[model samples]
Target: MQINGSVALVSGANRGIGRSFVEALLARGAAKVYAGARQPERLADLVDAGKGRLVPLKLDITQPADIAAAAGRCRDVTLLVNNAGINLQAGLIAAHDLAAARAEMETNYFGPLAMCRAFAPILQGNGGGAVINMLSILARVNLPMYGSLSASKAAALSLTQGVRAELATHGTLVVAVMPGAVDTEMERNFPPPKLAPAEAARAALDAVEQGAEEVYPGDMASGMSQGLAADAKAVEKDLAKYLPA
Candidate 1:
């Protein structure tokens, strides 16, 4: 959909990929952007850039009240970007911390699920719009460090597909964007070569415009996907080499 004059709401907009999406949406001429974060004041830069077009909303996806409040506050939004997430300190099923695994699900999976549920009617009421859920390459391939994240993303990916099908009748577009390592604070501790946030944001926007159901934003993600598709078990085996014994 044409972003110009559209209103968007992006969760986790205070920093990282979420911040990039907020900036990119505004650059594309969104009439307004509700920048949602646990601490709304953290979005001061975005507020400044929007020059009154950016409205900060307090959102903690784990809380139903916050979800409802955000829905009420950004009722006119035509685009919803589910960009908030958390990476739990857990490993594979064998070495997993059940609590941490559940935390990942609460934030990475259920968070977006709740957001989509809350926003669907809002978008439909606004004449139908789009929902973008940020995913990761880990969604398809489970690694030790990314075990919880992988499972959560996998669930979110399924939700993305289901929501896409269900929302289509209402003219709402639901997309899942699975990008590889991105140069962001989230990856500060575990550095990996990655595409710049700006580049990933650009590709994401383009994917939405082109009606892509799933977007792999960077070359690294794209390449890995191709390899995995060709040999899933083999890829998993190779990935094991990088994990601790």
Candidate 2:
């Protein structure tokens, strides 16, 4: 569905790519946008900038009550942007504990899944709206440097595929937006050549308008995706080198 008149809900709208998504959606003429954040007070600036079209939703995708409230109130939402996630920069076993790994899965995997489930009926009611899941190239290949994060995103990618198949009959466009390392605080320690959050958001919105199911927003991500297509083992081995000391 086109964004010009769509109602969009973007999780983790307080900062990073989620913030960019809200701005991009508004620029694309979305009728309304629900900016969901665990701390809605942190969205004061965004709410102010949005004038009247941005609605601040106190939503913590990890919380059932929050998800339920958002779904009930934002029944008009036609687009769901599952952009909320955390990368604790933890290695699966090297971290000495599983806390970071579990946290990453909760926020990056279960959170999005919960949101998708809560909003599926709403999107269906709204004439088969669209869903844009913000993923990473890490979804396809593990970067042991950020092993747990890679694992969580990989799970999310699977969830995205499953959701796409399930919602196909409803005409809901489920999009997996994969970008290279993004230049967000979340990736501050990551190397250069990172794609800007705004650029990724624009590319994703463009994909939505174009009715694309899967999109690689940056050159690095696009190239890596192709590499995986041609030689999965080679790409896997190459990525394994990123394992931290």
Candidate 3:
């Protein structure tokens, strides 16, 4: 889990927290980083700035073929950051977009799971490399306004735990990073107390280095996690205020 000299691969590295992770990894002296994005052209500037240390990878995490291709090509990777995800503002009830909800589950939960499955052996081969999953506070408690997205993240949390248990034998460190309303395009519509993408990325990389299995990056996520641990029902009731419009 040392960042320096470690080869890393990050999904959705074109923008948002994913892009921040690429920058942080480079700043921390990672030997090389494979920046994965749906459109590799979007990463042209990063590739230029990388000065050969950054390699742009064509990847759409939701596609099994893309996952396979990434695994096949990035064999030297020692760290996998599952940062690709989406939230279409769907809910479980009351005029929510079922299609959008399904998309959330596909991208948020299944994509990461597939990436982990595909790369587990590669990580083991690379001497027990680590995996960092970008989760959210919503993974712990449902926000009725985006209940579908919450459910998807909850599933991802479970997936992270299960992967952690299964990969324990190889010593792969599976880290789950939960942050609230990261200041990225993904959360542009959210309220205050949002964490800067760089800060969140730094926290996640810190967790990877410290061997922390779970990290809550900001005050909002930290408070929500504490509230869930203290009183699950109360947290649910509080989040219910944001029910779907």
Candidate 4:
């Protein structure tokens, strides 16, 4: 499905990669973009920036009522971007926050799953649209800081594949967009040398326009992907060097 002139919905669109997605969609000529966030007020700037191209929708992916209401309201939606997620609260396998881990799963893993389930039918009814899930290369690698995030994204990758197969008949385009540390609020305090959100968003849109099933965006993502395919154990060992001591 071409992004140009499509009715698109992007969750977590208030900041970071989601915000970049909203901008990219407008640039690609999307007819209308329903930008979703936990606090719709946060998207005021986007609405103002888009000058009528962006529509704010209040949504909390973990909430069933929110999902149902969004699905109903955006019934004409043809492009769905699941960009909401959370991070690890403690070190890998740390018992410090089992509850936090569970919460991460709800937002990082089950959140996309829920959106897909709710919007799959709408996309089908609209004559086969595209669904893009923002994932991390951490899905293929484990790091101390990414324990919960890695597990969650790996589950989401599986969900993307499974959903793709199941929704094939519906002509739905399910794509998993894997990228490394984006220069966004998520990584603002981490350090330098991160891919800009604008660049990552552009790469993803390019891949989608080319009908790619999976996309690895940016140098970090591409490098990590290649390393994993060549020797995952070696990559794991090497990635350890970059982790904080």
Candidate 5:
């Protein structure tokens, strides 16, 4: 699960934590990084800087065709970072329609699940590498404001565990990274004390190298997880008050 000399593929590499993952992988001396994004041109700078080590691939995790294509193209991948996700900011009860909630599940939950399904064999063939799923602290405790997103992440967390068990025979390491309130455009209007994407990305990679099954990347995430472990109801009640911005 080491980063150095690994052939990695990171979905949603255009920006946010995904972009940070790509940068960190390069800095760690990865042999090659296939940056997956909806628009490949957005990764031109990274490709140039990679000097042939970074391969940009068009990928939309919600689309089966895109996942199939990426799996075919990045067959040598030893590490898969499922960083592609969407937050509709929809509430289970307050939202006008179910469309946004459905979209959230498609991207945040089903997307990573599909990637794992497609890449498991590739990783098995390449020596059972690793899969890192970018989750959230909200996954452990449902925040009423973004209930749909939280629920999707929660489902993803469950999927991560199942995948880990199934991939154990192949030696693929599955790491669920739950970071609280990352300082990204998606959380621009969110409360302060957010962890920077780069910091979160680094923490996640470190956990992978250390062979941790689950990682709470920042102080907030770690603290919140601890709280949930102690009193799940208290944490749920506390998060129930915050409304979407």
Candidate 6:
């Protein structure tokens, strides 16, 4: 679905790629943009700068109450961006506890799943707009250092596909955005060649407008996707070099 003239809600909009999405949506002429965050106060500057176009909403995607409340409050929303996520640096086997891994799954996998479940009907009522899930290239291939996070993202990726098929009857466009390391606090320690948050956000929106089911927003993601298609084992072995910490 096109972003222009759309009413959009973006989760995790206080900072990182989520914040960038809020900005890009407004710049693209969206009628309204709901900047959702666990702490709505963190979006003060963005709300102010939105000049009445941006609405700050309290949203902790992991909470059922928050998801329901957000759906009730932002009923006019046509575009839902499920961008809220966490990377706890958890490894599947090497981590001291499963707590961190479970936390990652809650925020990264189930959170978005809940958001989509809550928003699907809203989108259908509003002419079946779109839902964008901010996934990662790692969803297709595990990174041993962040194995748990990768596994959670893979679950999200699978969820994205299933939701796409289910939502098609309603004409809702569900797009999966898979990008490599982005230059956000989430990947601050990662090596160079990271995509800027703004660039990644813009590309994802572009994909939505273009009716793309899946988007690889960066060179790294695009290359990796191609490599995985050609030789999955080779790509997995290459990624294995970055062992768990």
Best by lDDT: 6
Q: Mind giving the per-residue lDDT tens digits that candidate 5 earns over 1-245?
A: 78999999999999999999999999999999999999999998999888889999999999999999988888899999999988888889889989989999999999999999999999999999999999998889899889899999999999999999999999999999999999998889888998999998999899889999999988899999999999999999899898765
- Model 3, global lDDT: 0.93
**Which 10 successive residues of model 1 have the least lDDT summed?**
88-97
* Residue-by-residue lDDT tens digits, candidate 2, 146-204: 99999999999999999999998988999999998899999998889999999999999
Instruction: Give the per-residue lDDT of model 6 (tens digit) for 1-245.
Output: 67899999999999999999999999999999999999999998998889999999999999999999999889999999999999987678899989988999999999999999999999999999999999999999999999999999999999999999999999999999999999999999999989999988999899889999899988999999999999999999999998788
Model 6 residue 169 distance off true place after TM-score fit, in angstroms? 0.5
In candidate 2, which residue pairs clash?
none
* Clash count (model 3, backbone only): 0
Model 6 local distance difference test score: 0.94
TM-score of each: 0.95, 0.98, 0.98, 0.95, 0.98, 0.99
Clashes of 4: 0
Per-residue lDDT of 163 in model 1: 94
Each candidate's lDDT (Cα)? Answer: 0.86, 0.92, 0.93, 0.87, 0.93, 0.94
RMSD for each of the candidates: 1.5, 0.9, 0.9, 1.4, 0.9, 0.7
Model 6 scores a TM of: 0.99
Local accuracy of candidate 3 as per-residue lDDT tens digits, 1-245 = 79999999999999999999999999999999999999999999999888899999999998989999999999998999999999888668774347888899899999999999999999999999899999998999899888888999999999999999999999899999999898999889888768999999999999999999999998988998899999999999999899887
User: Candidates ranked by lDDT, best first?
Assistant: 6, 3, 5, 2, 4, 1
- What local lDDT does model 3 show for residue 22? 97
Off by over 4 Å in 5: none
Q: Which stretches of candidate 1 lie over 4 Å from their true place?
A: 93-96
* Candidate 2, residue 159: lDDT: 99
